[model samples]
Target: MNSASDLGALAHPAATPAALPTFDDVLAAAARIAPHAHSTPVLRSRTLDALAGCELHFKAEHLQRAGAFKFRGACNAVWSLPDATAARGVVTHSSGNHGAALALAARTRGIPCHVVVPHNAVAAKMAAIRAYGATLHHCEPTIAAREAACAAVQAQTGAELVHPYTDARVIAGQGTAALELLGHDGRFDALVTPLGGGGLLSGTAITAAAVSPATRVFGAEPAGAADGFASLQRGERVLELAPDTVCDGLRGLLGAPNFALLRAHRVEVLLADDAATVQALRLFWQRAKQLIEPSSAIALAVVLANRERFAGQRVGIVLSGGNVDLDALAGLFASA
Candidate 1:
């Protein structure tokens, strides 16, 4: 078991915070992803503002296709592949959102999609992947096992590997959320995103640094899986506690490329306990009337916990996804 405290010390062999992508990289990414992604809505919450002591603007990516911002990057990666490369289809290892997103994207591009999914992944997400006509390859729950299984699948299928987060094209596509948020309104003092694999937040940092340079970018992680926070403090990348936290979507460790971009941009990382995240998720549902995943609630948790930091300022938050199961949600927020 990896303690949150020990995460700072776990050394990643190839970890280094260099090669931050430039504004041009983000611009190109926006162009590449624009055709495939929706310009998701920007939502404001009066009740949430009252609670957090800040004016909050939410980029409602949960309303996005495939129910998450993951679709944007997935589509970009799939489309960017050469025709010959895409002929064999694209493959990735994802627990849920990315799998479905890639499946849908590949279907659009007239290519096959293969997703290596963990046996314990959310049932709804798996169903979505199947609905998009993608083949599923099951794997063990561990990150290493997942990666290994993906490699085996790629070798057998001769598919182009589209990593969920690590690839540059994917990062660029993820950055489009920040682009739309800033483009719609550059009034935010800070932009906060849940730090899962550091995909959207890294892209957020990249885009914010370019268009809204004055706006600070921050990442929120589950306290139980605070590897990103630890890595930032240690000046290196670190892996998370495997299979920890109810925020399953945010379980992945910060990828090397994302860690590098985050460090270069000096993105602040914060951790919220599962209790806090659950409360925030409930609050968003009850008060804001917005459906979101626990990972999405981490951003609001940070604002509510650290009022002084965001108080009276405009803060932009990305509502990353809303793919939670109905039964699970009933259990989560049932009357006490």
Candidate 2:
């Protein structure tokens, strides 16, 4: 077993502020990911805009290769590794999509991949991870258990740990989505994305800060798992969470580096109840004709909930993922 000090080192924030990736790094990541990642389309819905009272630009990352924006970070992390280190393969702990993303990324590079997964992860995501040929190590849902499992795998296989978030390379990779989103003609007043570990939100915030400083970045989170909201308010990373939301993908603990980036960029965190998220999920499906997870739906939910602030403005949203389990949809929505 790893010592408490070792785990503490892994959990704590990096000391130097320079650890955050620069805008130039995001640009480099965009070029690096071009071969493996897709430039997901920017979609607009007349009905969605009318409902939200804003010109909504949706970055359709759900249609990405691994069914989420996570592939951007995962692919970047995998390829960033030196040939010698990459040959040893890679490992990580994830609730679902990140695991699947990393697994697929490793496959493209002809490498072995291992993932430490919680038993409660969505079935469809778990299936996708295995389909990508990654060996799965099941563990309890708690962060401690997940990290321990990941460490064990790393120790045994000599694999490099590509953390789901908090890594500079991963954050840069996640920022590439926003780089592409901002590359379009319109200038957005606010951009929103679902926040979990803060990889996507931090990356997006970093990109927005450089590319479009006037644009405010918003993080939509489940009220039941409102760590991001709590952290931003308290000015520190908060991990004590008893997540009880239907958006399984947004339940991960907030990341330290991710918290620092959000703070630096002054990103706003918004909360929505599980019921509202479900309602928004249906609204997105009906209006935009896109099948997104409850996590992604929450991004639009917060904006719609605060329509007055965004009225007659331009808004950009990252439709983060679409890997929800169809079989569990009935029960998930019924709970709300």
Best by lDDT: 2
- RMSD in angstroms, candidate 2? 4.1
Task: Give the best candidate by TM-score.
Answer: 2
After superposition, candidate 1 runs with Cα above 4 Å error: 1-21, 140-145, 240-243, 334-336
Clashing pairs in 2: none
Name the regions of candidate 2 deviating beyond 4 angstroms: 1-18, 119-123, 140-145
lDDT of 1 at 224: 76
TM-score of 2: 0.92
lDDT, candidate 1, at 9 = 13
Point out the worst 10-residue segment of candidate 2 by lDDT.
Answer: 1-10
Give the clashing residue pairs of candidate 1, or none.
Answer: none
